[model samples]
Target: MNKNKKVIEVKNLKKYFNVGPGLTLKAVDDLNFYIYEGETLGLVGESGCGKSTTGRTMIRLYDATAGEVLFEGKDVHKMSRAEHKDFTRHAQMIFQDPYASLNPRMTVGDIIGEGIDIHRIMGGKERMERIYNLLETVGLNREHASRFPHEFSGGQRQRIGIARALAIEPKFIVCDEPISALDVSIQAQVVNLLIELQRDMKLTYLFIAHDLSMVKHISDRVAVMYLGTMVELASSTELYDKPLHPYTQALLSAIPIPDPNIERSRQRVLLEGDVPSPINPSAGCRFKGRCRYAKDVCHQQMPELREVGPDHFVACHIV
Candidate 1:
């Protein structure tokens, strides 16, 4: 554990949306987590679990309804305009869909150099040189930067997005499912590239992905969320070896084993009920409906994330 290397600290973070006149959507409900310098923290959950919202809100894409996001021991939301501008240079995001994220009308070079232009970091020739260098770093050539986004493959387009993020010389990046839209074979290539970049540039990442196998491979610590609430968090090996929460156990059970004998021997745990809606969620455990061990206490009181073991936390009545 890197005790002295805290880069981003999130405490009791909440992001609520007004769905209607009186109703509210609890996208990220009282979440608390942290990211260390030069480390990859993986946030994993099913669809609509608020993993993406948490990442976006931390970077101030959506104004957080409550809680503090501290970057380098300073409150990120409370920064001055000049400080915020500097923050933008140090922090960046890679969107889920590379095609939708990039501008269709702009050439790849322009898209990559947009941040440099906005920040006034370089002249015309210098900016073009940086763009070409960024493209090369992301496995794309300088010539490819002359074409529009439509001219590239999904993986190649994602490379362009990565180049754009790198153009600003960011120290931290929010990888919002950057490879979800790519081919399975290409997924590994992208992950490898990210790993290489981290090694070379000492970049820190908050890698949000629903793919458990891939998350385990890339993350230093793993956090599990359910219906806008975090249920479990721990080191990758610890989470996989001994998942404390009922939801975490069920999720791990569903991962298929390659060996025929092991696969046949392992029993699959299938939950009975569907995930409850985030909007106007019941005042209790959000995962109560699908938890086999859920009791009356689970329906009456929400579980706070508590330390179960060394660096392992879980939110469940049984835990």
Candidate 2:
């Protein structure tokens, strides 16, 4: 992917929900970022930090509360019915839970071919061949396509999910924690398959996960989120080596070092207090309540993401 060319642009994206009488929950609050074509942009944050919601909203699975998402220079939310169908065909998603994501009732072949049939891409023998090919592409066989999802193991089921995502031949995919539910041994296998598939397909990916280590391996760029706001965005190597935001530093510090000597010597940035509620976040920094270097201004006004270095962006008053 050319780092200069953006395939998807998310501008001031906000997604909220009315939980109850007069109460609102801000799931994703004013997020702004761009994903380059054929590149993996990692969205990392602690669980319930709006990572999944952002992916869903960007894909139009959930409507936006405000702001716009541009796909190849066209606003996704503003698309007409015909354009919306085209958008769906151009983009796909690999969900977190393979077991739950796959239909228990549908055969693997039918599940994978659902999109093909809906789009009327091919029918009968042609569609059957395509399903078989997709199964093989994801490391399964033609025979397994006739079986139900429950008959396969967790890893195999995820492969089926991958096959299903690829059935439509999408240019972009939102991988929402696709490997988090797999076994540690199986996680690497799935991630490797994704990387290989991306290279072969020239696919752009918005890979969302809380697992920093895995994200580093697959992503070209990484964005750190706190509560519902992005605190830092930079290349994977740069962000992991010299994290600018305090929240980012805290997150990277928690990744265990393989070397025992370095592990014991390195100081951990232990964050205090729980994550603040998104219902009504603090004024300035979303992480101010837990940040060690909080100042008066940090509570008075929110900080916008600013370019701190080449290809690096950070949203913090003190960064």
Top candidate on lDDT is: 2
Task: Note the residue pairs that clash in candidate 1.
Answer: none
State how far residue 307 of model 1 sits from its true place (Å): 0.7
Residue range 1-319, candidate 1, lDDT tens digits: 3557988999999999998998999999999999999999999999899999999998999888999999998788889999999999999999999789999999999999999998999977888888889998999889987999999999999989998998988989999999889999999999999999999998999999988989999999999999888999999999999989988888888899889999999998898877788999988899988888989999999999999899999999887
RMSD value for candidate 2: 0.9
Cα displacement (Å) at residue 96, model 2 = 0.3
Q: How far is candidate 1 from the true structure (C-alpha RMSD, Å)?
A: 1.2
When summed lDDT is taken over every stretch of 10 residues in candidate 1, the lowest stretch is 1-10
